[model samples]
Every structure is written in C-alpha cells, then in structure tokens.
Target: MAPKVLIVLSSHDHFPANGKPTGWYLPEFAHPYHVLKDKAELVIASPKGGEAPLDPNSVEMFKNDPVSADFLQNSQELWKNTVKLADVLPKVNEFDAVFYVGGHGPMYDLHYDPTSLALIQSFSEAKKPVSAVCHGPTVFLRATSASGQPLLTNASAVTGFSNVEEDQAGLTSLMPYMLEDELVRVTGGQYVKADQPWGEKVVVSKTSNGAVLITGQNPASATGVGQEILKALGVN
Candidate 1:
C-alpha cells in the first residue's frame, strides 16, 4: 500500500470577532500537496467533513503561481471531497503522518475544537509524524498526552505565526488573541521565530518515543515546511 498522509484543513470560513472572510491559505496546502501527492496517498480531512473554506486574500495573492493556480482550478473538486475528523480518528493507524495546513481560519475553528485536539494527540500517541505550518499550529493549543501534560510543554523547539508578524500584518488588533503569546505563556511551549518576522523557519522536534513533529513559520515557509515533513516521514 502507498504510505498515506492525512491533511487536515480548517472548516471555518471567517475570522472570529471582525467577521472577516478567511479560511485555509491556498499555498500552504498547494505547495505541500504538490510535493506529497506523488510520494504518498494524500487524504484531505476537515472538522465539518465536506467543503473547507479558503481565505480570500490568499486566493488573490497566489492566483498566479502554478501550484496555486492548479488549486484554484480544482477548488470545487477538492472542497466537495473532504472526510470528517471523527472518521479519521478511528482509522488513524492507516496514516503514516498527519499534517495541519494553516490559515487565519484555523485560529477560529481548529484552535478550539476538541476533536481536532484529540486527533493530534492520537497521531502523537501512535508515533506518527505530525506536521503543521503557520497558524496550523493553533490546533495544538488544546492537545495533551495521556500522561496529562500539555503536548508542547518545554518542547525543544517550535515555530508558528508570530506576534510581531501579526503586528506587521497590522491585524494584531483583530485576532482573538496573540498566537505567539499563547504558545509560550499558556501552552508552556518555547516559541521560536526568525530574527525577522515572517521569514522561512522550520523546527523538527522528536519525542522521547520517536514521534516526529515538524512546524513552519508562515506562508512563505510553506514549501520548505512540506519538504521537511516529507523528509521526516522518510519519503524520498
């Protein structure tokens, strides 16, 4: 059988407070999907199980890129075919890895969904590679192991969308909370970002039992982050 990868996308279609349209970033999924589809069987799953939403801005920004163009061309086909997070939990063993594709929408939905948290813990407990990029790391906010400790408590290294980047984007005032602060202060995670905000940063950390975790900093880091995930999974 081909090695299988579970790609989790946010089901949300808007940002929380402002009610602004937002969803999964196209490049975050497209870049990695293009690389991994040939190497593994890619399964797109979402909280709601059917169609996942795409952030409007990302669609405009990446419309010209070849990979993103393909995603746009096939958006209807992709959205029509996602599986539920619940369905994936029972068959977690069938997957070689689980990857969380990121966007502002993830902060609104996956960040607080108990099922999403359970799914991440399931992959971790199974010793499978778990990969996330940008705000996709938001899914980890509520995940914990069977031992009762927070999943990221004092982890060697991790990176995600940063506070300064939020400020740089001039949307810090709009989000529910600062992601960088939550990772460090609330989750007991050691948050790391590039010297400058939004730079390509990836952190590959392993648990004592050999479970692998790979994280990327932001949208620009999406392609490199996906390559790192492929590497961690032993894909050529």
Candidate 2:
C-alpha cells in the first residue's frame, strides 16, 4: 500500500473583521490533491470536521481547471466528511506525512489551535514530511520540537504570503497581523519570496537541525509543493 497523507484544512469559515466567508483555498487543495492522490493514500481532516468551508474567491479561481473540476465533481464526500484534527493527532504515526492547506481562515483558527500544534510536532518528531502553503504556514506559529525549541528555528528557507502581497490585497488592516512579518519577525524563520506577486515559488529544504519541510509562496505554488512532498516521501 502507498503511504498515507493527512490533509488538514482550516474550518473557520468567517472572516471575523468584515464577516466575509473564508475557508481553504480550492486550488491549494485541488492542485496538491491531483499530485498526491495517485501517489499516496490521502485523508482529509479539519479543525471542526464536516463540510469544511471553501473560500468563495477560490471557487472562481478554479472554475476552469481540471483538478478543480475533479474536486467539484467528487461525490465521495471526502472533503465533506473531514475528521476532526483533535482525533487525528493521536494516530499521527499512521500517516507518512501531513499537509496543511491554506486560506485566510487559518489565521483565525489553525494558528492557535492546540491540536494543530500537536499534529505538526508529532510529524516533525517522527521525522516525517510536514508541508504547508500560503497562510497554512500560520500553524508553525505554535509548532515546537521535542526539545521544546522552535521547530523552524533552523529552517534554511521558508515562503508564504508575503507582506507586499497582503498589502497589495488591501487586507493588511483586516488581518490580525501580517502573515509574512509574523513568520519573519515573530517566528524567527528565514522567510523569503518571489519577486512578482502570485508568482510560483516553492522552497524545499532540510532544517539545519534536520527536518524535511516543503513550503509554497501562494496558490500558484501548490502543485510544486505537492511535487516536493512526493520527493520527501521518496516517490518518483
């Protein structure tokens, strides 16, 4: 049997400040799903479980994409039946890797969810691959190593939504804190980015202290992040 990957998505669907609906970005999940579905067994889970919200904007972004079509056409209820994150943490050893999909929703929940912190820490301590993209990196804010040191303290390079992009999106004031600056200034990780907005930039590196991590800058980098995960899993 192929290795199993657990996909953890944020269930917080409301944008607190403006009360706008927000959830996982479709492309981030679809693109990676297409890449890993054939190579590994995937289990979808969420903080709250059951019908995790899909960001309204991502619906239009993926309207014409085949992977998106597969997602929309999926009648399996895989996404609809997402298990709770709290339940999965204890069985972390059953999964070969764990992937956190992104959306602004994570800023509201996963960033501070205790179960999320445990899941990430569980994967890291097992020396298994832990991947995230865009706002998904927010989970790292609470991830720590077995020794209780910052898990990303030795990461060579990590990328996520940059401050410039957030500023360009005109959501700076709306967000609790800028994801980019929080990762760089607060988390103390070496955050970097692509030159152009929405450009595809995937960074795969082993932390100086030895941990396999793969991160993507934005939605466009989703597939590449999956490819990196395959590599980390020793899949061709």
Candidate 3:
C-alpha cells in the first residue's frame, strides 16, 4: 500500500495585523503536492474544514510556474473541500506522515490552534515524520513533544521562513512574530537558513523524542521538503 500523507493547510484567510487577505501560499502547497501526488496517497485538511483560501498574491506571482498553475487550475477542489482536521485527528495513525503548507495565515492560526497542536502531537507520538515549508513551520512554534518540550527541541537542525526573507518581503511587521527568532527562542534548536534570501533550503531533523521534523525555508524549497518527506517515509 502507498504511504498515506495528510497535508494540513491553514484555514485562516486573512492577516490579523492588517486585516489583509492571506491564505496558504499557492507554490508552497502546489510544489509539494506535485512532488508527492503519485508517490503517496495524499489528503487535504484544515482546521475549519472547507475552502482553505490561497494567498491571492502568491497565485499571481507564481502563475508562470507550470506546477503551480496546473494545481491552481486542476486541484482547486482538493483545497476547496478540505476535511476537518479535528475530525481526522482520531484516525491520525492511519497516515504515515503529516505536512503543513504555509502562508501568512498559518502564523496566526496553526500556532495556537488546539486541534492543530494535538494533530501534530499525534503524528510525533506515532513516530511519524512531520514536515512543513515556509511559514508552515510556524505551527511548530507551539507544538510540543510527549515530554512537553518544544517539538523542535534538539532537532538536528531546523529551517523556516527566515527573518531576512520576512524583512525582504516587507511583511516583518505584518507577521505575528518573527518566525526565525521565535523558532530559536522557544526550541533552542539550530535554526539555519539559506545563504541568500528566497533560496531553496530544506532541513530534516530527528528530534530528541525520535520524531522526524522536516522543514523548508521558502517556497523555493517546498518541493525538496516533499521529496525529503517521501524519503523519510520510505516511500518511492
């Protein structure tokens, strides 16, 4: 049987800082989706269970990318009809891994969402890989291990939407908090980033508790993150 992977998306569609519209980044989700589509059985899900919005600007910016454009056109229904994450929590063991796809939206919701925290915890407890790209790693800011340490604690290495990248985007103030900073402050794990902003960077770490934590630094790294997840799951 193919490994089952649950892809979690943020249901929050607007930024709290400016009330500006934001959702999952198109490329962040699309790139990974394409990478794993055939290699694994994928499931789309969100906290609110329906119509997980796409960051409009990301849609516009990545419109030229063939994979992003293709997913935007053909896979709308997957995101439009996400399963309720809470509902899926009970059956978490049925999957081999969980992936979080990011945009500005997740910084506000998934970080503190009880359902999301519990779901991530479930995956870790099951000794499954938990992966995310870009702002998706923000979800780990609050997710804890069986021993109640930050999930990233003692992770071999970690990466996320970096402080430099956030500043370059001019969204540093719009974010709830600097992801790279908080990731380090809370976990004490090595938070590394690409040598250049917006460059591809993926880090796959085995946490002290034995859960695999995979993270990518930006949209450019999303596909690599997916590939790493497949490798970790022992999927072809």
Candidate 4:
C-alpha cells in the first residue's frame, strides 16, 4: 500500500477587492497533487469542508498552463470528497507526511488558526515531514514543536512567497500583513529569497532528528516541492 499523505489547502474564497474569488493557486495544488498521487494515497483537507477557491489570476491563459487548467476543472470533484480539517482524527503515526498548499487566502485564514497549528505540531512531534509552499508557511508562524519552542525559532533555513512577489501582484496594500517578512521576524528564522520573485523553487532543510521542513517561493516551485516531499519520504 502507498503511504498516506495529508494535503491541506485554504478555505477562504474572497479577495479583499470586490469580493472576488481567491484561495489556493491552481498550480500549487495541482502540480503537487499529480506528483504525489502517483506514489501515495493523498488526502485533501481544508479548514472548512467545501469548495476551495481558485485565484482568478491563476486561471489566466499565461498562468493556467495545461496541467493547472485540467486540475481546476476537476478540483470541485476532488474537494467534494476531501476530508475536512475539523474532522481529521490524526493518529500522528498513520501518515507519512503533511503538505500545505497556499494562495493569498491562507494569509488570512490558516495563519492564526488553532486547529491548523495543532496539526502541524502533532505532525512535527511525530517526526513526519512537514511541508509547505507559497503562503502556506504562514501556518507555521504560530506553531510550536513538542518541546514548547516555536517550531521555527532558530530554524536557519526557510523560504516563502517573497515581499517582492506580493508587491508585483499588487496585493501588498491589500493583505493584512507581509508573509515573508513577518515569518522571519516572529520565528527569527533566517529567511532566504530567490534571485527574482516567483522564479525559484522549494527549499528543504533537514532537522538534526531527520525531519524535513520544506517551503516553496511561488507557484513555479510547486512541482519541486512535491518532489522534495517524495524524496524525503523515500518514495520513488
């Protein structure tokens, strides 16, 4: 049997401006899902049990690409069968890994969520690979390891959607807070950036205990992020 992997996505569906639909970026969820599904039994979950919003910009011709467009059309069916985060009775030992997929929505909903925080802590304590990409890292801002230390405090290597990308997307003024900067500040984690915004892939840092925490810079990094997670899990 393939290992089980839990994939968490944001539930928020409204963009600040005019209540436009926005949630997980299509590619971020699609690319990773395809890769992982090939080798694992993937479970999709969100804070709420319903349709996950897709960023409008991510559906544009340039952004949709082939794979993402296919995923978007099928996402509803996929999510309709997803396990709600509220309903997840994690054993912490049943799953091989956890991955957080992100869009601007996660910045608002998942960041301070108590349940999401608890899931991360539980998975980390169990020594499962804890992975995130794009704004997904926001979930870690409030998560703590089993030892009572902030999960990311002193975590030297980490990455996330950069301020530059937020600025370029014209959403810096709209978001409640800056994700990359705030994460670095609160956790005191040594945050790093790519040469250009949205151009780089995921970064994985192995803890001394062999647990892996991985992050991606933007949608461009989604596939690489999934690959890293598979590698960490020792899946082909």
TM-score winner among the candidates? 3
| Sliding window of 10 residues with minimal summed lDDT for model 2 | 204-213
Lowest summed lDDT across 10 adjacent residues in model 1 is found at: 205-214
**Residues 1-236, candidate 4, lDDT per residue (tens digit)?**
88899988888888675676778777888889888878998888888866666677777833538778777676567765666786774555778889999788888788988888888887887788998889988988788877777787756688889999999888887888898888789657578878988797678874333468888888888899999999988888
143: Cα error in model 2, Å: 0.9
lDDT of 4: 0.81
In order of TM-score, best first, we have: 3, 2, 1, 4
- Number of the top candidate by lDDT? 3
- The candidate with the higher lDDT, 2 or 4, is 2
Any runs in candidate 4 off by more than 4 Å, and if so which? 16-18, 61-64, 206-210
Error of 3 at 70 (Å): 0.6
Better of 1 and 3 by TM-score: 3
Query: What's the count of clashing pairs in each model shown?
Result: 0, 0, 0, 0
Candidate 3 local lDDT, residue 194: 92
Clashing pairs in 1: none
TM-score of 2: 0.95
For all candidates in order, the CA lDDT equals 0.83, 0.86, 0.90, 0.81
Across 142-194, the per-residue lDDT of candidate 3 in tens digits comes to 88887898787778788999888889898888876899998888667488999
